[model samples]
Target: MGHAICEELEAHGENFIVIDKNESRTETLRDEKFDASVGDISHKDLIEKISMPPTIFVVSSDILANISFTERVRKQYPNVTIFARAADESTKEELVKKGANHVILSQEIVSNVVYDKIKKLEDSADAQKLLRVLKETEEKLAIIVHDNPDPDALASALALKYIGNGVNVESDILYGRGIGHQENRSFVNLLDIELKKIEDTDLNRYNKYAFIDTVPDANNSASVTPNIIIDHHEVTESIPDADFVLIDANCGSTAAIMTKFIRELNVDIPKEIASALLYGIRSDTQDFTRNTSPADLTAAAYLYPHVNYELLKQITSSVISVGTLNVLGDAIKNRKMRGSYLLSNVGFIRDSDTLSQAADYLLRLEGVTTAVVYGIIEDSGIYISARTKDIRVSMGEVLKEAFKDVGSAGGHNGMAAAQIPLGIFDSVKDKDSLIYLCEEAVTKRFLAVVGAEDEK
Candidate 1:
């Protein structure tokens, strides 16, 4: 895997050195580009042999085993950037304890792919023209999320707010249901993140509106004519008016990318805002140890001195919001299994992040290599989040297959999220068919991608 990354980087003209257990792979890359060496990445001797300190050092191998390896590299080359990968978000969190500059996950790779594709499409004349439509309004912008909010959604939204604010363009974040999620409530109380009611936000007031962590027209989003978009999730439709789109499958959090823009502009991030933004980066990337980039690390370090630690603690440990438990209960009770996957049915939900959290916890079960959690967050909208150990089978592709006809979908290598709008089919309407359909769709897709199953 390290060789593969080195190979890919070399293709892009990066001068890197590869140290691997399989010595032959190193020689193979000699013909491609970059330098190579053989030996355990954890060995001290191999560490000394790496003379050229790379700007980006990707920890693509096992997390626990690579911790010391990354530490040694960082200790030797403090300025070098480390891009690490974790098996799960929690594992990613654990990796952060090792002081990694940045951690990326397989799931995030999907986000990168999405962004790369968008970068290509954005060059087209038609796409460029549509982006202009979003710019029609020059001074003000409005940003929206789904009905309720989660850390990823909130952080992503806040990131855009900062970006809009940086350009001296007034952006009013419009949404409701900041009511649920204790952590959310605490974050609200501590940071006072501004928001505007969707109804109150006059599209006329803002020249353009951009959506974060959401692809308009696909989910239960009230607005889809977004002129600008910055998201980490998968989407099928091209945002109609977005002049510039930064959607990537490689990044874990939009905050991870949002921080990049903040750095680029050399803007001074307020301490409180830095705290919120840092927490957003920590929470989404699981602290630069998972689903991260060199940019995320740079942003984190830049924001570290500016963050309010006490406020961050308050928000992370805040009391659960009212009715949030009921939403979680539904996710647990309906949980079942398909192969090593714990398939849970969150019948109806209010928060999309809760459904994702439930799926995240389910992956910790013994003998399970993967877990799939699904639920509806009101109306006919069914939301899904998936996790897996198979690094080869990207959940993004899996999600696209599962939600092809049901809805638009995509994700990174290990984790993916999809929302199916069954509003068209009333029979499947209020029925328990959401989970059933999800299971069937996911199963068929999984079987096709992975030839054999249950080997573990």
Candidate 2:
């Protein structure tokens, strides 16, 4: 396992040093051109020779040895991140107390993967039906990703395009509002993904329109009527009559659903496609920390070995722009709190999608369970992004009820967004007055719907 970690780190061009007491193992690693040392990691002298703040992976099978080594490293470095392997829950707890920053339980991860595979076997039947539907479509097709698309949306679109290409049905991937997330931009630019903007596209040119990761007639996608809808979000609104529709709200990410289709069809998945799908699942599931299902795990495990690890590393580590940081700073300073809820208005933002980024960051606060971040775009009106971990209330449904009368809003249960036209508040010319009115209206409406507003 230590060797595997070293190989992965080296694969991503990350500078790392491997320490082992066994001379043979150290020698083998050195022969493989890796930085290696034959010394006890628990030794203070050896630890002092190394760099500070390094991420240490303790993969020894010996539970006591692992715990002892972690404790020693914690005492010496004090700030190094340690990932220790655990045999069971008790061992995991012990390692944590001994200063393991993260406990990687092999049994738990394996059992989850096994359960996912069993469930995936059942999902394959649906994938075959989906493939037949794709084969039924003749010639040209347009795959529409949700507006301001994320990794899950974009990857699902790519998977559909791959299936379409197999059926000899030429297809083009289209997105409305363009891609704005920095990581998303890197994914597309690095992978050379071709996406046509809806504004420049003619809907009449395609024989079939399929929406991936978005529901039909939801105000968040292309204006064209879709013949097919494949999504993983809860079906809240009435859907359009389409030739094919596959929506499993229980699935963690749309990428998982599309991955099933790709694997079931037994087609060759390009390296970039596999990496994109893997990233999509990880991003949407927050690295399997939230809203993850067995199918999601199975899809991710299946794609893991085939993914371009280097590219995935690069995409995930993409740098954030100064503009996004500024928006986040404003959001932090101006945030309002009501119980577990947090709302922030980032006065003005050039890219509306930055609101989502801010919301994600704010939700990480110690006591916050829900976060809503909004910013005014010059001519685009108020763009609001909401995220919640509280399962008692669905954020998407909340947004739909709050702003549906005056704006367009709807998304998955956990993550949702709304866009209100600037015309409604056009009467207020003063920038501060416009922001205040907008914030007051949105906060009241949202709080009332969520039953979070202060009672009179």
Candidate 3:
């Protein structure tokens, strides 16, 4: 196993050292022009003899030996990454518990390699289809993002623009609504991305339209037919009848799918663009905490070195307003727990985006796996934002089924929102009445939809 690993690393032109207790193995590695040492890796003195600690220590010996070596390394140099090979589930767990950064089962690795090869072939075919679309189009195209575009939507749009530029096809990134959240605004400003409001732009000026991060039937998307739809959201509703649809719900983020395009096209990703795409993937996947897939991690890895770390720091660390903080406090104070689900009403808020933020915060409460926060937005309407860690619940479908008759609603499985126009509750007399009406209507409808046992 050690010899095979050394050979593979050498094939990739990577510098590595081999440490083995067996003289013959050490001699064999040395014969192959590799740095070899004969010693027990678990010995502190033996490891210290190596000039410098490696960035990654590969443990390919038997499970017991690997675990022993990993534990020893972690004790001395806790920061060093350990990649250990395990023969079975028991050994895998032991290696992981002993501080292996990654534990690989030989069988699983072999199977995954085969699966990846097949996936690559399929990706190549799709890349050809994408190139055909770009090359065949003679006129300019419009890439429309969902309303109140977030980092994921904006970054995906930017990536598509890059792809369009590579093919010599002109494209403009457009959004149906303005960015409202503090983080989103910071992302756009820091990245220097230009997104035109679709309402202001003349749609007819563009010969074809494309949708990124959202489909035509989405409540947040503009009411326009698209020639291409590239999104990572689930197929919960009717998709846009685009000439080419590249929807991969398994990717976790639209940016992941767009990043794949950038790589397949062999186009250079600028530092600004790389930073934006990395931020998009992190934001959409909640830093790989919510609904993340392997592809999302892979895309993030690809963009890591090229990204502008300083700009990403600024974008993520942007300050939130006192109003948003107050709303979050109010949501927490008014929260009612039902099983693992918590529901709250913030009374009133001018920025409806605050509801989503509050819902996300409430979901972190102990014992609460799902949270629904609602508030009345001044002049606009009543808005409901829901978030869930429970895989059984599809937040988007829940919101749709709860209030589809009264308002526009839809989102991903883990997060969703709904809006009901104030005109629907015309019977309200005063501020107190309006608040009570909103609370009653929203709570009853949401609880009914989610089928919670009780609300307290």
Candidate 4:
């Protein structure tokens, strides 16, 4: 149960330092990607040892630990949102009284899941509710994804389009960035998925919009009131008001939730959609290695028969485009190592996806425990992508502190991103200085995270 929650947080880009009283409780997550400490969160000495202040305090270990540990962490990190597991409503009340911001009753969750499943059995009310929303002939629905939409974002957008259109609504899937990754481009092309920049889109033309696989405040690209929201990340308190929110932290990918939502409508899972959704789950969950959920497995099982295994095989072998390779090469050439960390600069790139891939590629090196990739993107700004094998160093905290004065940047423990706008980008070459500054800024941020820099 504990590992499942940690996996969800990791998947959704929320970094956390997990504390377990019994060291063995975190054994399942050992050697896995995350910042997990074995000790007592309530212990003052142990709390002081924490390098990154937790944003979400999860107390899913035990009832007593839940109350004591959550209160302790919440008191230390006053702004942190507390999520505690409870046995009953009374327990929830007690947790809330003790300072938990969000109290999740274990029994209530079971009841709700059973209730939803039973609603499926008893009557088709759930279907009718969405069908009513979908049958609004005057409404146009645009399924939007956040900046530089990833596989999860793409898959969620597609799944939403299928359902919204099936129920008689006009829908189109939109993205804020170009699909440049080899696997992403192949998946998009093979699926015939049409993606467009969100800036060029008129959200006002469509009264109904759905945010797929992302939170609005989390990424400004999909900044709109969503009629429907679907995501599979750690729960955030400030989720925007939506007609419906299908955020199952237990699921590995939002695509899994979207696929199930579509399946309930009894529509045929198109070959293209199934393929895209499967790829989304595979990519977001790191081929089910990082954060595979039971729901993800169930949805994959349903989609497997409909997917084109042949196409998937072909996609795997698809060659990387020349443009991506150029940027990737530059990133590697500029790679610099500092102890367990490796920082690289890709002077300029066309998209954030390339920067992220560069970071991922760099982190694969044996000596690199933390990898930060930066690049300049014309007039848009400087983009930074950081990934880490260091389970202790929260990349989210590092980026947040590093870019706190410069720009916005925060995410899960292992992966995070930051961007700072440039005053001018009149020519392509002007990006060189910004890229260098971005790289240097990341280094400074690392120094802040580990400790103050000293003359070496």
Sort by TM-score, top down from the best: 3, 2, 4, 1
Candidate order (lDDT): 2, 3, 4, 1
Q: Which one wins on lDDT? A: 2
If scored against the real structure, what TM-score would every candidate get? Answer: 0.63, 0.72, 0.72, 0.68
Candidate 2 error regions (>4 Å) = 1-125, 219-221
Worst 10 residues of 4 by lDDT: 114-123
lDDT of 2 by residue, 264-358 (tens): 87888899999999999999989998789888998998999889999999999999989889999999999999999999988878887789899
What lDDT does model 1 reach? Answer: 0.64
Model 2: how far residue 181 lies from native, Å: 1.4
- Evaluate model 4: give its TM-score: 0.68
Deviation of model 4 at 405, angstroms: 4.4
Q: Is candidate 3 or candidate 4 better by lDDT?
A: 3
Q: Looking at candidate 4, what is the lDDT of residue 36?
A: 63
Write the residue-wise lDDT of candidate 1 on 1-456 in tens digits. Answer: 455565465554444566667667667766665566666766677766656453444454557766777677777776455666677888778667765655667666643443343233322322333234443557877877655655666766776676555546667777644345567667766777777777555667766777776667544345546777777765655556556666765566667666665655556777776777788778767566556766567767888887888888878777654465665666577766656666776666666767666777777778777777776656646667887776666777777775677686666677777777756445664356755665565555555555435532
* Candidate 2 accuracy as lDDT: 0.83
**Whole-model lDDT per candidate:** 0.64, 0.83, 0.81, 0.72
The local lDDT score (0 to 100) that residue 59 gets in candidate 1 is 56
**Which residue runs of candidate 3 sit more than 4 Å off their true CA positions?**
1-114, 426-431, 453-455
